[model samples]
Target: MRVFIVHAHHEPTSFNHAMTSEAVAVLTGAGHEVMVSDLYAMGFDPVSDRRNFVTVTDSEKLNQQSEEAYASAHQGYAPDLQAEMDKLAWCDILIFQFPIWWLGFPAILKGWVDRVFAVGRAYGGGRWFDSGVFAGKRAMCSMTVGGPAPVYTDSGVYGSIGSILHPIHRGIFGFTGFTVIEPFVVYDPKRLGDEERLACLARYSERLLVLDSAPTIENPNTADYEGFVLKSVQDKHRGLD
Candidate 1:
């Protein structure tokens, strides 16, 4: 499978960087194609605005969605943004490798989504969720946490990690029609010993090889809903991976 990994971390020697490097090495060694976008190294801009498009829908106020739709039709997105979209289109798997900050993705990664995952290209019109543009693809979040695993649990100080990542898994990956596999989270890498870190990398390598058979989080099927809400109690029984 062709995989696109977007790596967002500033430190080259950091564990986050190690994870991305390990992923590329392991995936490529397995004979799978891989492409990586290291946001910081690329000097990627996190801000999204009129700069996102070379095609202008309106010269006055900025309506990003409207402009995106127009750009999608006219190939108006700036070359850089369009390039990212092309990578997304080419990949069978999409992975966001980053350090979780404030319970979410970094600004650069978020902006990557804001600009690249635009209307008509990623999602728009009647296409979303199970029917979204990337319906056949699979996506995963590989992140490092600031705290220990226990701190991110149900009764822990930060609540459940699943709850913290709901917006990303459901709103972005799921909404865009990618089957989101369970996130691979490394908690408090700063606290881990060198041996532990090496073991962690080994574990990640194993995870990459079995992604096809890995457990996936369920996403609501559009068929089970009407007007974006569940149609009936029976609708709850049907879900898509």
Candidate 2:
């Protein structure tokens, strides 16, 4: 398997770094090719705009999607974006390693998504959900949370973890056509003892070994919807054909 990890933590000594390192070591040791994009280290500019493409569809106003479409047709992606797109195309499994900040991806990571997930290259023109541009690939989030598991539960203050991650899982990975793997989350890692941290790494290694077989979240079938609303829901008002 080929794995590409997009790491989004600034601190080298952080637990997120350890998770990424563990993934690279484990995957490489298992004979899988691995690549890491250390966003902070790379000094990646997360801001999306004309900076994403070398071509312009409009000069007076900025229409990002139009520019992206033009870039896709003209090979005009900025060198940095092109490199990231190449890796995304090359990988079988994509992993996002980051600390969950305020119930979502860090601004840098979110910006990475804004810039990297282009219209023509990633999704557009009836390409989304199961039929997205990355249809055959798989993606997973390896995240560390500041709070404990219970705090993220349905009845807890932070709400369900699954709901919290819906934007990334459903909107991003699933929309882009990657099989969404159940996230591997580390909660309150800072409070864990050395032994516990080591155990987490061991468990992560185990997950890496079974990347292909890992259980995945199901994506909505594009066939079931007319545009965005479910056909079943639409049928409730009108009789089914």
Q: lDDT of each model, Cα atoms only?
A: 0.91, 0.92
TM-scores for candidates 1 onward, in order: 0.93, 0.94
lDDT of 1 by residue, 1-241 (tens): 9999999999999999999999999999999999999999999887899999998979998999999999999989998998899999999999999999988889999988888899999998878889999999999999999999999999999999799989889999999899999999999999989999999999999999987778899988777444546445346666431
Prediction 1 global C-alpha lDDT: 0.91
Q: What does candidate 2's lDDT look like per residue over 1-241, in tens digits?
A: 9999999999999999999999988899889999999999999999998889888879999998888889999999999999999999999999999998988999999999999999888999888888889998999999999999999999999998799999999999999899999999999999989999999999989998998989999888677444446666678769873
lDDT of 1 at 39: 93
Candidate 1's displacement at residue 225, Å, is 4.4
Q: Where does candidate 1 have its weakest 10-residue lDDT segment?
A: 225-234
lDDT of 2 at 83: 98
Q: Which runs of model 2 end up more than 4 angstroms from their true locations?
A: 227-241
Error of 1 at 181 (Å): 0.4
